[model samples]
Target: MEELINSAKALNAKKLVVLCRLEPGCLGPDGIDHIDAFCQVAERALVNFNADICHWCLAPRLDKSLIEIQYSLAGKVLSRDKAIKFISSFEQDLDVIEERFEDKLTQLINQYIARKR
Candidate 1:
C-alpha cells in the first residue's frame, strides 16, 4: 500500500485508486455485508495518506465469464464495466489488469494536470 501511495505521489496524483479482485465465495457466509465492513477498515487504514483514496472491488461473473467493476471517486461513480472478459490464466489475467489500470491512471493524471494548467 505504501508503494501505491508513493507511486501516486510520483505521478503528482491527488487521488489514489486501489483495485482488488473479490473472488467468489471468498467473503464467507456473510457475503455482501462483509464488503462494507472491509471498505470501512480500508478507509481507516488509508486516512493518513493525504490523497483521495478510492477502492474498487472487482468480481467475476462465473456464469457469463466477465468481470464487473464499479468504482467511485468523491462520491461520484467514475466507471462501471460489466463486460470485461479475460481469456488468459489467472497470473496472466492479473498482469493484464495491472497494465490496463496503470495506463488508465496515467491518462487520467495527465488530463487532470493539463486541466490545472
Candidate 2:
C-alpha cells in the first residue's frame, strides 16, 4: 500500500482511475480493510508532495477477497472547454457515455487544449 502511494507521487498523478477485478483469492480480508485506508494514504502523500489533483476509483460492487487495483498519474492540466469537455466534474461519465464512445477522445482532447490557449 505504501508503495502504491509512492508510485502515484512519483508519477505526478492528477487524475486517477482504478479498475478492480473480482475473483477468488485475489486478496485477503485485510485487503478489504485497506480500501478505505488507502484513501488516507493518498491524501497524506498528496499533502506531502503538494499535489493539486487527486482522485480514486474502486470496483463498483465487489467483495474484498476478489479485488483488482490500478493507479494512474496525470500531470496535465484538465481543460474545461465546452466543445470537448467530455467529462465534467458536475456530471457522471455515464451521462456522456455514448457521445464519448463515438467521438475520438484524443482528438477532442487535443483540439480543446489548442483552442483553450
Candidate 3:
C-alpha cells in the first residue's frame, strides 16, 4: 500500500484508483472482514500522505460482476464506467499519465503567470 502511494506520488497523480477482486462470500466468513481491513489500511496510508490527491477503491461485486467504486477516505460509493476507464487508463501507460500531469501543471502555471502579467 505504501508502494502504491509512492508510485502515485512519483507519477504526479492528483488521484489514485485501486482495483481489487472482492468476492464477499467466496472467501468464507472472514472475507468481507479482510476486505474491510485492507480498505482501512489503504485509507490510513492515503490520509497520512497528506497530499492533495484523492484515493478511490474499485471492487467488483461477485454476484452481479458490477464495479463498486468507493472513496477510500470517506467510504462513499461512486461510478462504474468511470472506474473501468480509470483502470484502463492506468494499464495503458504510467509514463503517459505522468507526462500529462506535468503538462497540466505547466499549463496552470502559465495561466497564473499570464494573469499576473
Candidate 4:
C-alpha cells in the first residue's frame, strides 16, 4: 500500500479518492482516471497479476483496513521500493503509513478542484 501510494504521488495524483461503503464491504476504493492507473500498478505489484479495477476493485469479504490502505494509497506513490519496504513492516513504520495516506489527502484536493471547476 505504501509503495503504491508513493508511486501515485510521484505520478502526480492531484486528487486521490476511494469509492466504498461507509462501513467497508463489497464496495472498494476506486479512482476516476489517474487514480485508476495508479492503483492498477499498485495492485499488480502486490499480487503480481493484471486485474480489472473498474470491473471489480472490490472484494466480497475484505477487511476495512485493507480498504483504508487502498483508498489511502491511490495517487501518492513516491517510490515502489520505499512503499513496499514500508508496508512490509507497517507496525514499525508509522511515518510511512502516514505519508502513504496522502492518497486520501489527494482526494480532498480533488473535491476542492471539482468545486472550482
Runs of candidate 2 with Cα error greater than 4 angstroms are: 1-29, 48-117
Task: Tell me each candidate's TM-score.
Answer: 0.27, 0.22, 0.28, 0.21
Tens-digit lDDT string for candidate 1 (1-117): 999988866553323243444433334454454544443444454444323233333333333343444444343444433112221322234345556655653453344335435
Candidate number that wins on lDDT, 2 or 4: 2
Candidates by TM-score, descending order: 3, 1, 2, 4
lDDT of 4 by residue, 1-117 (tens): 999989855653332223232222112233232343344433433231111121113222234453333333444433445544544553344344445434544464455345434
Ranking by lDDT: 3, 1, 2, 4
Better TM-score candidate (1, 4): 1
Which lDDT tens digits does candidate 2 get at residues 1-117? 999999866664534333323332223344454434443433343342212322433332355554344434363433234313433443544235424322432343334335435
Task: Assess each prediction's global lDDT (C-alpha) against the native.
Answer: 0.41, 0.38, 0.44, 0.37
Residue-level error in angstroms, candidate 4, position 74: 31
Model 2: lDDT equals 0.38
**Alpha-carbon runs more than 4 Å astray in model 4:** 1-92
Q: lDDT at 88 for candidate 2?
A: 48
Per residue, candidate 3 scores C-alpha lDDT tens digits across 28-92 of 45556444544444345444231334343424355555543342222334364454455455464
Leading candidate by lDDT: 3
Preferred candidate (lDDT higher): 2 or 3:
3
Q: Top TM-score: which candidate number?
A: 3
